[model samples]
Target: MVRRLPFLLGGIALFLVNALTLSIGFGFGLSGVPAALLIAAPVVLCWYRPMAAWWLALAGLLLLTLLGPVLSDDEALQYRPWLLNAIPAHLAVVYVLALSVRLRIAIPAFVIYLAAGALTPIHLLDDLPNAIAGAIVWAMAVLVAMVLGHNKRVRLTSTLRIAEERGRRLVLEERNRIARELHDMVAHHMSVIAVQTATARYRLPGGVSEEASREFQAINATARESLREMRHLLGVLRDPADPAETEPPPQGLADLPRLMESARRAGTPVRLAVVDTPDPLSPAAALTAYRIVQEALSNVVRHATGAATRVEVAPDETCSALIVEVHNAPPDAPPPAVERPHPGHGLVGMRERVAVHGGDMTAAPTPEGGFIVRATLPLASSTGAGEPSPDVMDGGDGRDTSDDQRIDRR
Candidate 1:
C-alpha cells in the first residue's frame, strides 16, 4: 500500500484539477498540461537525472507562466492584478527547480505545483477556500522533497557498506595465500640449514677454536627449531583434502623421543610417562599429537630455560584417546621477555590443529608456577596398527636411558 501511495495521490490530484477546469469551462489542455507536470515531478525525480529533470521543469514553468497571461481572461482588468502573482509564481518555480537539482530531491518536476499555489490568490482574489487549499499543496510539495533527499542518502550508505565488505574479504584471501607460500619456501631452507650445521659440528677438527664450535652448535640448533616452527605454521594453512598440495611432514606422539633427546642435549631435565600403549594413530591425528608435544616442549625451552619440566603421555583404553601434557617451573623472576609474540605462535598453531580433529587443548599459566599445555587426541583402533610407529627410544618412559635427568617414553 505504501509503495503505491505516491501514484494514488498523484492520480487524485490530477483528477481534481481536470474536474475543476471542466466545470469552470476552461480549456482541457490548458489546465490538464500543468496538472500532469505536477503529478509527474514525483515519479520523474525517483529515476531521472537530477540536473536534467530540473532544467526541463524550469523550461516548462516559464512557458506555462507566459501562456497563462496571454490565454486567460482579462477578468475585470481594473480590480484584478495578474502580474504580481505571476511574477512571484515564476520566481518561486525557478528557485525550486534549482534547489531540487542541488538537493537531489525526488519530486524534481512536481515543485511547479508550489508556484501554481502562490499564483492561485491572484486569480481567486479573496476566496478563502482556494487560498487555504493552495497553502496545503505547497506544504505537501516540500514534505515530498525532504523524504526523497533522506532516501537518496540511505541508498548511498548501503552501497558503500557493501563495497567495504567486499574489499575486506579480498584482503583476507590474499594474506592466506601469501602465508602458505612463505611456509613452504622457508621450511625447506631451514631443513637444509639444519643438516649442514650438524655435519659441520661433527666433522670439525680439534684445532677449531671453542668459539667457532659453539657458534656452529648454536646455528644448528636455531635452524632446526625454525624448521619445526615453519612446518607447524604450514599445517595451519593446509586446506582439507587438497592432494595436489601436500602438507608439511606429519609430527605426532612418535616424535616425542626425538624431542626429549634434543632437550637432553641442551642439558634440560625432561621427565616422561606413557601409560596405556596402544597401536599407531591415524596420520592426521598423529600429526596433531606430534605438534602439540613439539610446541609444548618448545615453549618450555624458550620461556623456562634451566627450569625443570615434566611431560606425561597416557592412552585411555576405555575412551580410545591419548592424553599428552607438558609442565614446567616458572622462570627465575619476570619471564624471559619475548621481543614479540613469536613464541606464542607454536601454542596457537597447536590449538588450531587439535580443533580441526574435534579434539581439545588447554594452555595457560599454571596456578603453582610456570605454564602447562595439555592435549587429548582420539584414537581409531586399539589392536591393529594403522600407521608405522616412528623409531622411538622406548626407554621405561620413551625418555633417553643414559641418565635419570632426561627420558623418552615411546
Candidate 2:
C-alpha cells in the first residue's frame, strides 16, 4: 500500500485533469494532456526513484507555471501560474522522498520545494489573497509529508533492526543446542579413551616397558586435556539465559505423530504414515528423520495453513534408505491471515541433516497449488531397516489402506 500510494496520488492528479478537461468549459485543450502527465509523472516515479522523481516534479511544476497561462484556453486560469491539483502530487512525491532517503537529503529537497512554492505565487492572477492561500496550503502539505514520512521511516528502521537481532539470536540458540548435543557424544568417547590409556600399563597381561608406559601416560594426558577443552567449548556455546543445565531428550520418529497432532489442533489438516523400519534407526538418524518431518509440517502450517497435508515416511524401493515425503493439498478456504513470517525450514536444515547421512531431499510446489517436501535418508547405518511394514499411521483427520499395518485418523 505504501509503495502504491504515490502511484494512486499520481492517478488522482491525472483524473483531476481529465475531469476538468472534459467539462463544458475552457480547458488547456489538448495541451492539458501532456501537462497532466508531466504533473503526475513524478508521483508515479517516486516509488522507484525518489530523487529523480523529485527533480521531475520540480521541472514539471516549473514548466506548468511558466507555460500554463499561454497554453490555457481558459481566461480565468491563464495567469494562475499554479493549480491546486499540483499540491497533492507534490505532497506525494515529497512524502515518498522523505520516507525513502535520509533526513539531510529530504530536508534539502523540501527547502527547494518551499522556495519554489514561495516564489511561484509572486505572479499570481488573483494577487495577494490567492497567493497567500496557496502558500499556506503548500507549507502545510510539505510539513505533513515531512513529519509523517520521517516517522514512518524511523518506525520501519526499528522494525528491521528488531527482526535482524531476532534472527541472530535464533542462530545463536541453534548453535548452542547443536553444541550441547555434540558435547554429549564426544565427551563420552573422550572419557573412554582417557580411562583405557590411563590403565594401559597395568591392564596388559604382560607389563609394558617404561618407554611404553611413558607413551601411555602421555596419551592419557592428551585425552584428558581434549575432554577439558571440549567441555569448555560447550559451556561457551550454551546460552547463559537458558536455565536448564541438562539437554532435552532428542526427538525421534515416535515424536512425529505428536507433532502432526499439534499441527492439526492449529487448523492444518494433517495425516501421517510411518512404515516401521525392520531395524531401529540410530538416534542421530531417527532425530534427523523426525526433524525433517517436523520442519515440513511446520512450513505447511505457516505458509499454507488450512491445507490438507499428507506425510509419508517409508523405506525406498531398494530398502536401503528411508523416504519421507510431505505433500500439502490445496486449502478448502482462505487462510486466517496472510501466511505468517515462516522462519521454519521448508527443507533447509533438513537437507543438511540428510546430507550428513549421505541422503538427499527435494521440496517443491505441487501442481495443484500446494507444496511437497521429499527426503531420502539412507538406512544403511541400520541393517535390514529399509523395508517398511504395511502399517497405517494416523496423523490427524483421516486413514489410508496399507498392506502390512496402518494407523488412520479422520
Candidate 3:
C-alpha cells in the first residue's frame, strides 16, 4: 500500500483537477482532449489491450467534445470550427499510440500524424501556438509506448532463460544421486555373497556330494569376479582431481592377448590377433578400445556359455583408425540363453568414451549365430597441430616404457 500511495493520491488529484477545469468552461488550459489521453493511456495499457483502450479513448473524446457545450449551454465553443477540428484530430492520435503497442509502426506514420495535427488550430481557430502545443504532446506519447514495449520483452526473455537453467541443474543432480546408490548396493551385496559361498565350500568334507562341491565353488568364483567389475565401474565415476586415487591399469592393444587368456581360463576359448600396433594410442582412445572389448567379452561369458570367441585389433593406415572387432560363436546347439540383458549403460558408456574424442562404434548380432562388437577409434594428434608440439607419450619414441599396468591418477 505504501508503494502505491503516491500513485493513488496523484490519480485522485488529476481527476479533481480535470473535473474542475471542465466545469469552469474557461478555455481548456492545454486542449481538454489531449490532457485526458495523456493521463489515461498508460493506465489503460496496463489493465487492458491496445484495441480496447483505443475504443475507450474514442468514446471519451466524443463525450468531452460533444457534451461540453450541452452541459455548459455555451454555443460559442460547441459549434466552433476550431474546437470541432481539434477533437477528432486528437482522437486519431490516441488511436495511433494504441496501435503502436500492437505493431512495429514505421517512422512515417508518426511523422504524418504530427504534421497534420500541427495545423488544426491554425486552420480552425487561427491560433498557431495551440496547434504546436498539441503536436508536441502527441510526440511524447509515442516515445513512452516504444520504451515500455522494449523493456517488457527483454524482462520476459531473461526470466525464461533463468528458469530453464535451474531445471537442467536439478535433473543432473538427481541422476548423480541415483548412480551413487546403484554402485554402493552392487559392491556390498556381491562381496558378501562371494565370501559366504567360499566359507560354505571349505567347511564341506570329502563325504559331501560332488555336485554340491562344484556348485559352491562355481558360485564363489562368479560372485568374486562380479565384485571386481562393480568396483571398476564405481572408480570410473570418481572425480579425477582427488589426491587419494591411484592410476588404473593401462588398457590398449597390448592387453588383448591377456584378456583372451583370462577368458580361456573361464572355459571360453578365445583367439586374439594384433596388427599395426607398433604405435600406442592416446589414453582416451586406448580406454575406449579396452571398454568395447571388455563389455563384449563380459556379455559372451554371461550369455554364450561354452562359446568360442575371437578378437581382432588392427590399424588402418588409410583412415588412421584403430579398428577393434570381437566376435563370439557358441556351439552348434545354442547355449541356453541366459535372460541376462545388457543394461545399455555399458554400451552407452562405450559410445560416450569414443564420442569424447570424436570416434564411432557399432554393436549387433551376425546371421551366422554369433554376436559382433566393433569400434574404430581415431588416433590423430591430440593437439591437432594447433599448439606447441607435445612430448611423445614416452620420451621421443612411440614405445611406452612405463609399467603397462600403471595408471596416472594425477
Q: lDDT per prediction? A: 0.54, 0.70, 0.53
Worst 10 residues of 1 by lDDT: 401-410
Model 1 segments more than 4 A misplaced: 1-48, 62-66, 72-123, 126-128, 201-410
Q: Which lDDT tens digits does candidate 3 get at residues 125-187?
A: 554565456546655655455445445545666788986885565444334433544455566
Residue 33 displacement in candidate 2 (angstroms): 1.9
lDDT of 1 at 142: 49
Query: For candidate 3, what is the total of clashing residue pairs?
Result: 0
Ranking by TM-score: 2, 3, 1
On residues 44-139, what C-alpha lDDT tens digit does candidate 1 reach at each position?
Answer: 342334455445545544444444445445432211112232222223333334433444443544554455435545545556575556556555
Candidate 3 residues lying further than 4 Å off, grouped into runs, are: 1-10, 25-133, 197-200, 203-410
Evaluate residue 169 in candidate 1 and report its C-alpha lDDT on the 0 to 100 scale. 54
Query: Backbone clashes in each candidate structure, one number apiece?
Result: 12, 13, 0
* Model 2 residue 174 distance off true place after TM-score fit, in angstroms: 1.3
Candidate 2 Cα errors over 4 Å, as ranges: 1-6, 9-13, 16-26, 73-75, 79-82, 199-210, 243-248, 251-289, 297-325, 330-369, 373-410
Worst 10 residues of 2 by lDDT: 401-410
TM-score: model 1 vs. ground truth: 0.35
lDDT of 2 by residue, 287-402 (tens): 77777777776666656667888888887665678888889987776555443233442343565677778988877777888888888887754456544554454444322111
RMSD of candidates 1 onward, in order = 19.4, 7.1, 22.1
**After best superposition, candidate 2 residue 290: deviation in angstroms?**
4.0
